[model samples]
Target: MKTLLLLEWMKVRKYKTFWAFIILFAISLAGINYFIHNVQIQTKSLTHGMADIQIFSFPQIWSTTAWAGGFSVLLLGILIITLVTNEYSFKTHRQQIIDGISRKQFISGKWLTIIVFIIFAWISYFILTLIVGNHTENISVFSGFDYAGYFLVKMAVSLSVAFMFALLFRRSGLAIALYLVYVFILEGIVKHFLDKIAGGLGMFLPLSAGGYLVSNPMRQAIPGIETIHIQPVWILLTCLGYLILFVYLSYRYINHADL
Candidate 1:
Protein backbone atom coordinates (compact mmCIF):
# COMPACT_ATOMS: atom_id res chain seq x y z
CA MET A 1 0.00 0.00 0.00
CA LYS A 2 2.82 2.35 0.84
CA THR A 3 4.48 1.60 -2.47
CA LEU A 4 1.24 2.27 -4.30
CA LEU A 5 0.66 5.53 -2.42
CA LEU A 6 4.22 6.65 -2.94
CA LEU A 7 3.88 5.98 -6.64
CA GLU A 8 0.72 8.05 -6.76
CA TRP A 9 2.40 10.81 -4.75
CA MET A 10 5.33 10.94 -7.18
CA LYS A 11 2.86 11.49 -9.98
CA VAL A 12 0.76 14.02 -8.09
CA ARG A 13 3.70 15.95 -6.65
CA LYS A 14 4.74 17.33 -10.03
CA TYR A 15 1.28 17.67 -11.52
CA LYS A 16 0.49 21.40 -11.82
CA THR A 17 -3.13 20.76 -12.68
CA PHE A 18 -3.59 18.71 -9.54
CA TRP A 19 -2.31 21.56 -7.39
CA ALA A 20 -4.50 24.00 -9.31
CA PHE A 21 -7.58 21.94 -8.66
CA ILE A 22 -6.64 21.54 -5.00
CA ILE A 23 -6.21 25.27 -4.58
CA LEU A 24 -9.43 26.01 -6.37
CA PHE A 25 -11.34 23.52 -4.25
CA ALA A 26 -9.92 24.99 -1.04
CA ILE A 27 -10.81 28.52 -2.10
CA SER A 28 -14.28 27.52 -3.16
CA LEU A 29 -14.99 25.77 0.13
CA ALA A 30 -13.75 28.69 2.23
CA GLY A 31 -15.28 31.36 0.02
CA ILE A 32 -18.70 29.77 -0.06
CA ASN A 33 -18.77 29.19 3.70
CA TYR A 34 -17.56 32.73 4.38
CA PHE A 35 -20.26 34.16 2.16
CA ILE A 36 -22.95 32.10 3.88
CA HIS A 37 -21.66 33.04 7.30
CA ASN A 38 -21.89 36.70 6.39
CA VAL A 39 -25.36 36.18 5.03
CA GLN A 40 -26.43 34.53 8.25
CA ILE A 41 -25.06 37.46 10.21
CA GLN A 42 -26.66 40.02 7.95
CA THR A 43 -29.96 38.22 8.01
CA LYS A 44 -29.94 38.24 11.76
CA SER A 45 -29.20 41.95 11.89
CA LEU A 46 -31.67 42.86 9.20
CA THR A 47 -34.45 40.84 10.67
CA HIS A 48 -33.73 42.10 14.19
CA GLY A 49 -33.65 38.61 15.68
CA MET A 50 -36.92 37.67 14.03
CA ALA A 51 -35.14 35.22 11.77
CA ASP A 52 -31.99 34.10 13.47
CA ILE A 53 -30.50 30.95 12.01
CA GLN A 54 -27.40 29.60 13.64
CA ILE A 55 -25.68 27.79 10.85
CA PHE A 56 -22.16 28.35 12.16
CA SER A 57 -23.04 27.39 15.67
CA PHE A 58 -21.62 24.21 17.25
CA PRO A 59 -23.74 21.29 16.12
CA GLN A 60 -25.18 23.00 13.07
CA ILE A 61 -21.69 24.00 11.98
CA TRP A 62 -20.85 20.41 11.08
CA SER A 63 -23.85 19.98 8.83
CA THR A 64 -23.54 23.49 7.42
CA THR A 65 -19.89 23.03 6.48
CA ALA A 66 -20.45 19.52 5.19
CA TRP A 67 -23.38 20.64 3.07
CA ALA A 68 -21.39 23.55 1.73
CA GLY A 69 -18.48 21.21 1.04
CA GLY A 70 -20.67 19.30 -1.43
CA PHE A 71 -20.40 22.00 -4.05
CA SER A 72 -16.63 22.06 -3.82
CA VAL A 73 -16.49 18.26 -4.21
CA LEU A 74 -17.40 18.76 -7.88
CA LEU A 75 -13.98 20.24 -8.48
CA LEU A 76 -12.34 17.27 -6.79
CA GLY A 77 -14.40 14.98 -8.97
CA ILE A 78 -13.05 16.69 -12.05
CA LEU A 79 -9.55 16.41 -10.68
CA ILE A 80 -10.02 12.68 -10.16
CA ILE A 81 -11.30 12.26 -13.70
CA THR A 82 -8.35 14.20 -15.07
CA LEU A 83 -5.84 12.15 -13.09
CA VAL A 84 -7.35 8.80 -14.14
CA THR A 85 -7.83 9.75 -17.76
CA ASN A 86 -4.30 11.16 -17.91
CA GLU A 87 -2.97 7.73 -17.02
CA TYR A 88 -4.65 6.45 -20.19
CA SER A 89 -3.87 9.50 -22.33
CA PHE A 90 -0.16 9.27 -21.56
CA LYS A 91 -0.17 5.45 -21.62
CA THR A 92 1.41 5.39 -18.19
CA HIS A 93 -0.96 2.70 -17.05
CA ARG A 94 0.50 0.36 -19.65
CA GLN A 95 4.02 1.44 -18.76
CA GLN A 96 3.36 0.57 -15.14
CA ILE A 97 2.09 -2.85 -16.12
CA ILE A 98 5.11 -3.42 -18.37
CA ASP A 99 7.31 -2.47 -15.40
CA GLY A 100 6.02 -5.52 -13.44
CA ILE A 101 3.12 -4.04 -11.49
CA SER A 102 -0.03 -6.13 -11.84
CA ARG A 103 -3.39 -4.71 -12.88
CA LYS A 104 -4.53 -4.93 -9.27
CA GLN A 105 -1.61 -2.80 -8.13
CA PHE A 106 -2.37 -0.14 -10.70
CA ILE A 107 -6.02 0.02 -9.73
CA SER A 108 -5.09 -0.12 -6.08
CA GLY A 109 -2.83 2.86 -6.65
CA LYS A 110 -5.74 4.75 -8.10
CA TRP A 111 -7.92 3.83 -5.17
CA LEU A 112 -5.22 5.02 -2.78
CA THR A 113 -5.08 8.28 -4.66
CA ILE A 114 -8.80 8.62 -4.24
CA ILE A 115 -8.51 7.93 -0.51
CA VAL A 116 -5.81 10.59 -0.19
CA PHE A 117 -7.99 13.12 -1.94
CA ILE A 118 -10.90 12.26 0.32
CA ILE A 119 -8.73 12.71 3.40
CA PHE A 120 -7.48 16.05 2.18
CA ALA A 121 -11.00 17.24 1.49
CA TRP A 122 -12.27 16.02 4.84
CA ILE A 123 -9.41 17.72 6.68
CA SER A 124 -10.04 20.95 4.83
CA TYR A 125 -13.67 20.88 5.87
CA PHE A 126 -12.81 20.00 9.45
CA ILE A 127 -10.38 22.91 9.78
CA LEU A 128 -12.73 25.34 8.11
CA THR A 129 -15.58 24.25 10.31
CA LEU A 130 -13.47 24.88 13.39
CA ILE A 131 -12.36 28.30 12.17
CA VAL A 132 -15.88 29.37 11.27
CA GLY A 133 -17.64 27.79 14.21
CA ASN A 134 -15.32 29.37 16.74
CA HIS A 135 -16.93 32.79 16.28
CA THR A 136 -20.43 31.49 16.80
CA GLU A 137 -22.11 30.70 20.10
CA ASN A 138 -21.90 27.01 20.84
CA ILE A 139 -21.81 24.80 23.91
CA SER A 140 -19.98 21.72 22.67
CA VAL A 141 -17.37 21.35 19.95
CA PHE A 142 -18.22 17.78 19.07
CA SER A 143 -21.97 18.03 18.93
CA GLY A 144 -23.38 17.00 15.56
CA PHE A 145 -19.86 16.17 14.44
CA ASP A 146 -21.13 13.01 12.80
CA TYR A 147 -21.68 15.14 9.75
CA ALA A 148 -17.93 15.05 9.30
CA GLY A 149 -18.13 11.30 8.83
CA TYR A 150 -21.02 11.80 6.43
CA PHE A 151 -18.86 14.24 4.49
CA LEU A 152 -16.16 11.55 4.15
CA VAL A 153 -18.71 9.09 2.79
CA LYS A 154 -20.03 11.75 0.44
CA MET A 155 -16.55 12.42 -0.93
CA ALA A 156 -15.85 8.73 -1.40
CA VAL A 157 -19.12 8.15 -3.23
CA SER A 158 -18.66 11.22 -5.41
CA LEU A 159 -15.03 10.61 -6.37
CA SER A 160 -15.64 6.91 -6.93
CA VAL A 161 -18.39 7.85 -9.32
CA ALA A 162 -15.91 10.05 -11.15
CA PHE A 163 -13.32 7.28 -11.14
CA MET A 164 -15.78 4.84 -12.60
CA PHE A 165 -16.56 7.26 -15.40
CA ALA A 166 -12.88 7.72 -16.15
CA LEU A 167 -12.33 3.97 -16.22
CA LEU A 168 -15.34 3.49 -18.48
CA PHE A 169 -14.55 6.29 -20.92
CA ARG A 170 -10.75 6.66 -20.66
CA ARG A 171 -11.07 10.19 -21.99
CA SER A 172 -11.04 13.21 -19.78
CA GLY A 173 -13.26 15.35 -21.95
CA LEU A 174 -16.03 12.82 -22.35
CA ALA A 175 -15.82 11.62 -18.78
CA ILE A 176 -15.97 15.10 -17.28
CA ALA A 177 -18.64 16.33 -19.62
CA LEU A 178 -20.87 13.38 -18.96
CA TYR A 179 -20.16 13.57 -15.23
CA LEU A 180 -21.25 17.20 -15.02
CA VAL A 181 -24.28 16.59 -17.20
CA TYR A 182 -25.33 13.56 -15.22
CA VAL A 183 -24.82 15.20 -11.84
CA PHE A 184 -26.45 18.48 -12.72
CA ILE A 185 -29.10 17.48 -15.23
CA LEU A 186 -29.56 13.82 -16.07
CA GLU A 187 -29.67 12.44 -12.54
CA GLY A 188 -32.06 15.11 -11.36
CA ILE A 189 -34.36 14.44 -14.26
CA VAL A 190 -34.15 10.72 -13.67
CA LYS A 191 -34.66 11.12 -9.96
CA HIS A 192 -37.62 13.40 -10.56
CA PHE A 193 -39.34 10.87 -12.79
CA LEU A 194 -38.45 8.02 -10.49
CA ASP A 195 -39.83 9.88 -7.51
CA LYS A 196 -43.06 10.55 -9.30
CA ILE A 197 -43.35 6.89 -10.20
CA ALA A 198 -41.95 5.25 -7.07
CA GLY A 199 -42.26 7.96 -4.39
CA GLY A 200 -39.06 8.56 -2.37
CA LEU A 201 -37.18 5.73 -4.04
CA GLY A 202 -35.29 8.36 -6.03
CA MET A 203 -33.17 8.96 -2.94
CA PHE A 204 -31.40 5.70 -3.64
CA LEU A 205 -29.63 7.13 -6.67
CA PRO A 206 -25.83 7.27 -6.25
CA LEU A 207 -25.48 10.96 -5.58
CA SER A 208 -28.85 11.34 -3.93
CA ALA A 209 -28.06 8.62 -1.42
CA GLY A 210 -24.90 10.42 -0.37
CA GLY A 211 -26.68 13.77 -0.43
CA TYR A 212 -29.43 12.61 1.86
CA LEU A 213 -26.81 12.04 4.54
CA VAL A 214 -26.26 15.73 5.18
CA SER A 215 -29.32 17.66 4.13
CA ASN A 216 -29.48 21.45 4.04
CA PRO A 217 -29.52 22.67 7.61
CA MET A 218 -31.06 25.96 6.57
CA ARG A 219 -34.21 24.18 5.54
CA GLN A 220 -35.19 23.84 9.17
CA ALA A 221 -35.63 27.60 9.40
CA ILE A 222 -38.37 27.62 6.84
CA PRO A 223 -41.83 27.79 8.37
CA GLY A 224 -44.98 25.81 7.61
CA ILE A 225 -43.14 22.98 5.94
CA GLU A 226 -42.52 19.64 7.55
CA THR A 227 -39.07 18.26 6.83
CA ILE A 228 -38.94 14.61 5.92
CA HIS A 229 -36.22 13.00 7.93
CA ILE A 230 -34.70 9.72 6.79
CA GLN A 231 -32.63 7.54 9.06
CA PRO A 232 -28.93 8.23 8.77
CA VAL A 233 -28.16 4.54 8.97
CA TRP A 234 -30.24 3.82 5.90
CA ILE A 235 -28.66 6.65 3.98
CA LEU A 236 -25.21 5.53 5.08
CA LEU A 237 -25.94 1.99 3.99
CA THR A 238 -27.17 3.15 0.60
CA CYS A 239 -24.03 5.22 0.12
CA LEU A 240 -21.85 2.26 1.07
CA GLY A 241 -23.68 0.08 -1.43
CA TYR A 242 -23.10 2.55 -4.23
CA LEU A 243 -19.50 3.06 -3.17
CA ILE A 244 -18.80 -0.67 -3.35
CA LEU A 245 -20.56 -0.98 -6.68
CA PHE A 246 -18.61 1.87 -8.26
CA VAL A 247 -15.28 0.61 -6.95
CA TYR A 248 -16.03 -2.94 -8.05
CA LEU A 249 -17.01 -1.87 -11.53
CA SER A 250 -13.88 0.24 -11.91
CA TYR A 251 -11.72 -2.61 -10.69
CA ARG A 252 -13.39 -5.09 -13.02
CA TYR A 253 -12.84 -2.78 -15.98
CA ILE A 254 -9.18 -2.29 -15.17
CA ASN A 255 -8.65 -5.96 -14.55
CA HIS A 256 -10.13 -7.20 -17.85
CA ALA A 257 -9.97 -4.33 -20.34
CA ASP A 258 -7.15 -4.16 -22.84
CA LEU A 259 -4.99 -1.14 -22.11
Candidate 2:
Protein backbone atom coordinates (compact mmCIF):
# COMPACT_ATOMS: atom_id res chain seq x y z
CA MET A 1 0.00 0.00 0.00
CA LYS A 2 2.86 2.38 0.77
CA THR A 3 4.44 1.56 -2.58
CA LEU A 4 1.18 2.19 -4.37
CA LEU A 5 0.65 5.50 -2.59
CA LEU A 6 4.26 6.55 -3.27
CA LEU A 7 3.76 5.88 -6.96
CA GLU A 8 0.60 7.97 -6.95
CA TRP A 9 2.41 10.75 -5.07
CA MET A 10 5.25 10.79 -7.60
CA LYS A 11 2.75 11.44 -10.36
CA VAL A 12 1.27 14.52 -8.68
CA ARG A 13 4.25 15.76 -6.66
CA LYS A 14 5.17 18.44 -9.17
CA TYR A 15 1.84 18.83 -10.95
CA LYS A 16 0.88 22.46 -10.65
CA THR A 17 -2.77 21.73 -11.23
CA PHE A 18 -2.84 19.41 -8.24
CA TRP A 19 -1.28 22.00 -5.97
CA ALA A 20 -3.54 24.70 -7.38
CA PHE A 21 -6.65 22.74 -6.55
CA ILE A 22 -5.33 21.78 -3.11
CA ILE A 23 -4.56 25.40 -2.31
CA LEU A 24 -7.92 26.49 -3.64
CA PHE A 25 -9.74 23.96 -1.50
CA ALA A 26 -7.85 25.05 1.59
CA ILE A 27 -8.52 28.73 0.95
CA SER A 28 -12.16 28.16 0.20
CA LEU A 29 -12.66 26.28 3.46
CA ALA A 30 -10.93 28.90 5.59
CA GLY A 31 -12.42 31.86 3.74
CA ILE A 32 -15.97 30.66 3.95
CA ASN A 33 -15.75 29.90 7.67
CA TYR A 34 -14.12 33.26 8.35
CA PHE A 35 -16.86 35.01 6.44
CA ILE A 36 -19.53 33.22 8.42
CA HIS A 37 -17.85 33.94 11.73
CA ASN A 38 -17.76 37.63 10.92
CA VAL A 39 -21.35 37.58 9.85
CA GLN A 40 -22.34 35.94 13.12
CA ILE A 41 -20.50 38.61 15.05
CA GLN A 42 -22.11 41.36 13.03
CA THR A 43 -25.54 39.88 13.62
CA LYS A 44 -24.90 39.77 17.36
CA SER A 45 -23.90 43.39 17.42
CA LEU A 46 -26.81 44.56 15.29
CA THR A 47 -29.43 42.53 17.09
CA HIS A 48 -28.01 43.32 20.54
CA GLY A 49 -27.80 39.66 21.57
CA MET A 50 -31.41 38.75 20.80
CA ALA A 51 -30.46 36.87 17.62
CA ASP A 52 -27.02 35.86 18.76
CA ILE A 53 -26.51 32.18 18.13
CA GLN A 54 -23.44 30.46 19.46
CA ILE A 55 -22.68 28.66 16.23
CA PHE A 56 -18.98 28.99 16.78
CA SER A 57 -19.18 27.57 20.28
CA PHE A 58 -17.84 24.05 20.81
CA PRO A 59 -20.45 21.53 19.63
CA GLN A 60 -22.10 23.83 17.12
CA ILE A 61 -18.72 24.72 15.62
CA TRP A 62 -18.25 21.14 14.54
CA SER A 63 -21.48 21.08 12.53
CA THR A 64 -21.22 24.68 11.37
CA THR A 65 -17.74 24.22 10.04
CA ALA A 66 -18.64 20.87 8.52
CA TRP A 67 -21.67 22.30 6.74
CA ALA A 68 -19.77 25.32 5.49
CA GLY A 69 -16.90 23.09 4.44
CA GLY A 70 -19.19 21.13 2.10
CA PHE A 71 -19.01 23.85 -0.54
CA SER A 72 -15.23 23.57 -0.62
CA VAL A 73 -15.46 19.81 -0.96
CA LEU A 74 -16.54 20.37 -4.55
CA LEU A 75 -13.10 21.71 -5.32
CA LEU A 76 -11.59 18.54 -3.89
CA GLY A 77 -13.95 16.55 -6.04
CA ILE A 78 -12.67 18.41 -9.09
CA LEU A 79 -9.14 17.66 -7.99
CA ILE A 80 -9.88 13.95 -7.80
CA ILE A 81 -11.53 13.94 -11.20
CA THR A 82 -8.63 15.75 -12.78
CA LEU A 83 -6.09 13.45 -11.16
CA VAL A 84 -7.86 10.29 -12.33
CA THR A 85 -8.57 11.55 -15.84
CA ASN A 86 -4.98 12.66 -16.14
CA GLU A 87 -3.95 9.06 -15.71
CA TYR A 88 -5.97 8.19 -18.76
CA SER A 89 -4.94 11.27 -20.74
CA PHE A 90 -1.20 10.73 -20.21
CA LYS A 91 -1.47 6.93 -20.55
CA THR A 92 0.23 6.52 -17.20
CA HIS A 93 -2.35 4.01 -16.10
CA ARG A 94 -1.31 1.76 -18.93
CA GLN A 95 2.34 2.35 -18.13
CA GLN A 96 1.76 1.27 -14.53
CA ILE A 97 0.05 -1.89 -15.75
CA ILE A 98 2.93 -2.60 -18.14
CA ASP A 99 5.31 -2.19 -15.23
CA GLY A 100 3.66 -5.28 -13.72
CA ILE A 101 1.33 -3.70 -11.19
CA SER A 102 -1.98 -5.57 -11.28
CA ARG A 103 -5.19 -3.80 -12.16
CA LYS A 104 -6.31 -4.01 -8.56
CA GLN A 105 -3.14 -2.30 -7.40
CA PHE A 106 -3.63 0.54 -9.83
CA ILE A 107 -7.17 1.11 -8.63
CA SER A 108 -6.09 0.58 -5.03
CA GLY A 109 -3.45 3.21 -5.50
CA LYS A 110 -6.05 5.65 -6.73
CA TRP A 111 -8.29 4.85 -3.79
CA LEU A 112 -5.35 5.40 -1.49
CA THR A 113 -4.86 8.81 -3.02
CA ILE A 114 -8.53 9.57 -2.42
CA ILE A 115 -8.14 8.45 1.19
CA VAL A 116 -5.22 10.83 1.61
CA PHE A 117 -7.23 13.71 0.22
CA ILE A 118 -10.08 12.85 2.56
CA ILE A 119 -7.74 12.79 5.55
CA PHE A 120 -6.32 16.14 4.55
CA ALA A 121 -9.81 17.58 4.41
CA TRP A 122 -10.77 16.07 7.77
CA ILE A 123 -7.67 17.44 9.48
CA SER A 124 -8.23 20.83 7.93
CA TYR A 125 -11.76 20.90 9.25
CA PHE A 126 -10.63 19.81 12.71
CA ILE A 127 -7.98 22.52 12.94
CA LEU A 128 -10.35 25.16 11.60
CA THR A 129 -13.00 24.13 14.11
CA LEU A 130 -10.57 24.31 17.00
CA ILE A 131 -9.22 27.70 15.97
CA VAL A 132 -12.63 29.21 15.31
CA GLY A 133 -14.21 27.69 18.38
CA ASN A 134 -11.44 28.74 20.74
CA HIS A 135 -11.51 32.25 19.39
CA THR A 136 -15.26 32.38 19.89
CA GLU A 137 -15.76 30.38 23.08
CA ASN A 138 -13.67 28.05 25.17
CA ILE A 139 -15.64 24.83 25.50
CA SER A 140 -15.00 21.10 25.44
CA VAL A 141 -12.86 20.39 22.41
CA PHE A 142 -14.39 16.98 21.81
CA SER A 143 -18.00 18.04 22.18
CA GLY A 144 -20.02 17.36 19.04
CA PHE A 145 -16.83 16.19 17.37
CA ASP A 146 -18.75 13.38 15.70
CA TYR A 147 -19.71 15.94 13.09
CA ALA A 148 -16.07 15.77 12.07
CA GLY A 149 -16.60 12.08 11.42
CA TYR A 150 -19.61 12.92 9.30
CA PHE A 151 -17.52 15.38 7.36
CA LEU A 152 -15.00 12.61 6.71
CA VAL A 153 -17.76 10.33 5.41
CA LYS A 154 -19.07 13.14 3.26
CA MET A 155 -15.62 13.57 1.73
CA ALA A 156 -15.30 9.86 1.06
CA VAL A 157 -18.64 9.64 -0.72
CA SER A 158 -18.14 12.83 -2.71
CA LEU A 159 -14.60 12.04 -3.89
CA SER A 160 -15.55 8.48 -4.69
CA VAL A 161 -18.36 9.76 -6.83
CA ALA A 162 -15.88 11.95 -8.66
CA PHE A 163 -13.54 9.00 -9.08
CA MET A 164 -16.29 6.86 -10.58
CA PHE A 165 -17.20 9.60 -13.02
CA ALA A 166 -13.58 10.09 -14.05
CA LEU A 167 -13.09 6.40 -14.62
CA LEU A 168 -16.32 6.11 -16.57
CA PHE A 169 -15.68 9.04 -18.86
CA ARG A 170 -11.87 9.03 -19.02
CA ARG A 171 -12.08 12.72 -20.01
CA SER A 172 -11.51 15.46 -17.51
CA GLY A 173 -13.58 18.13 -19.20
CA LEU A 174 -16.67 16.00 -19.70
CA ALA A 175 -16.39 14.36 -16.31
CA ILE A 176 -15.96 17.64 -14.47
CA ALA A 177 -18.71 19.32 -16.46
CA LEU A 178 -21.14 16.56 -15.69
CA TYR A 179 -20.01 16.41 -12.06
CA LEU A 180 -20.68 20.14 -11.57
CA VAL A 181 -24.00 19.89 -13.29
CA TYR A 182 -25.07 16.94 -11.19
CA VAL A 183 -23.93 18.39 -7.88
CA PHE A 184 -25.03 21.97 -8.51
CA ILE A 185 -28.09 21.49 -10.65
CA LEU A 186 -29.37 18.03 -11.52
CA GLU A 187 -29.34 16.53 -8.02
CA GLY A 188 -31.21 19.45 -6.52
CA ILE A 189 -33.79 19.39 -9.29
CA VAL A 190 -34.25 15.64 -9.05
CA LYS A 191 -34.30 15.76 -5.27
CA HIS A 192 -36.92 18.46 -5.33
CA PHE A 193 -39.21 16.49 -7.61
CA LEU A 194 -38.58 13.32 -5.71
CA ASP A 195 -39.47 15.00 -2.46
CA LYS A 196 -42.62 16.36 -4.02
CA ILE A 197 -43.49 12.87 -5.17
CA ALA A 198 -42.37 11.05 -2.02
CA GLY A 199 -41.50 13.20 0.95
CA GLY A 200 -37.91 12.54 2.09
CA LEU A 201 -36.87 9.70 -0.15
CA GLY A 202 -34.83 12.04 -2.33
CA MET A 203 -32.16 12.09 0.33
CA PHE A 204 -31.27 8.54 -0.71
CA LEU A 205 -29.37 9.79 -3.76
CA PRO A 206 -25.62 9.31 -3.38
CA LEU A 207 -24.63 12.93 -2.93
CA SER A 208 -27.91 13.79 -1.28
CA ALA A 209 -27.38 11.07 1.28
CA GLY A 210 -23.93 12.41 2.01
CA GLY A 211 -25.31 15.91 2.35
CA TYR A 212 -28.03 14.76 4.67
CA LEU A 213 -25.38 14.00 7.24
CA VAL A 214 -24.79 17.66 8.00
CA SER A 215 -27.22 20.57 7.84
CA ASN A 216 -27.28 24.33 8.09
CA PRO A 217 -26.09 25.31 11.55
CA MET A 218 -28.22 28.44 11.61
CA ARG A 219 -31.45 26.67 10.94
CA GLN A 220 -32.40 26.93 14.58
CA ALA A 221 -31.72 30.66 14.77
CA ILE A 222 -34.46 31.53 12.32
CA PRO A 223 -37.98 31.57 13.75
CA GLY A 224 -40.55 29.11 12.42
CA ILE A 225 -37.98 27.33 10.27
CA GLU A 226 -38.77 23.76 9.30
CA THR A 227 -36.09 21.19 8.68
CA ILE A 228 -36.20 17.56 7.69
CA HIS A 229 -35.78 15.11 10.53
CA ILE A 230 -33.91 12.00 9.55
CA GLN A 231 -32.03 9.68 11.81
CA PRO A 232 -28.28 10.04 11.50
CA VAL A 233 -27.78 6.30 11.35
CA TRP A 234 -29.78 5.95 8.14
CA ILE A 235 -27.94 8.79 6.48
CA LEU A 236 -24.58 7.38 7.51
CA LEU A 237 -25.51 3.96 6.22
CA THR A 238 -26.74 5.39 2.93
CA CYS A 239 -23.48 7.26 2.45
CA LEU A 240 -21.44 4.16 3.22
CA GLY A 241 -23.54 2.15 0.76
CA TYR A 242 -22.95 4.64 -2.02
CA LEU A 243 -19.27 4.80 -1.19
CA ILE A 244 -18.94 1.06 -1.55
CA LEU A 245 -20.97 0.97 -4.74
CA PHE A 246 -18.95 3.71 -6.38
CA VAL A 247 -15.65 2.05 -5.51
CA TYR A 248 -16.92 -1.28 -6.81
CA LEU A 249 -18.07 0.20 -10.12
CA SER A 250 -14.85 2.11 -10.67
CA TYR A 251 -12.75 -0.94 -9.94
CA ARG A 252 -14.86 -3.13 -12.20
CA TYR A 253 -14.62 -0.66 -15.06
CA ILE A 254 -10.87 -0.23 -14.86
CA ASN A 255 -10.28 -3.93 -14.27
CA HIS A 256 -11.96 -5.01 -17.50
CA ALA A 257 -11.83 -1.96 -19.77
CA ASP A 258 -9.13 -1.32 -22.35
CA LEU A 259 -6.50 1.20 -21.36
Among these predicted structures, which one has the highest lDDT?
Answer: 1
lDDT of each: 0.89, 0.88
lDDT of 1 by residue, 1-259 (tens): 9999999999999989999999999999999998888888887898898779878888889999999999999999999999999999999999999999999999999889889889999999999998888553447888888999999998899899888888888999999999999889999999999988998888889898888887787777778875556788998999999888877887788788899
> For model 2, how does the per-residue alpha-carbon lDDT over 6-55 read when each residue is reduced to its tens digit?
99888899999999999999899999999998988888898899888989
Off by over 4 Å in 2: 45-48, 135-138
lDDT of 1: 0.89
Lowest summed-lDDT stretch of 10 residues in model 1? 132-141
- For candidate 1, the TM-score is 0.95
Clashing pairs in 1: none
Model 2 Cα shift for residue 160 (angstroms): 0.8
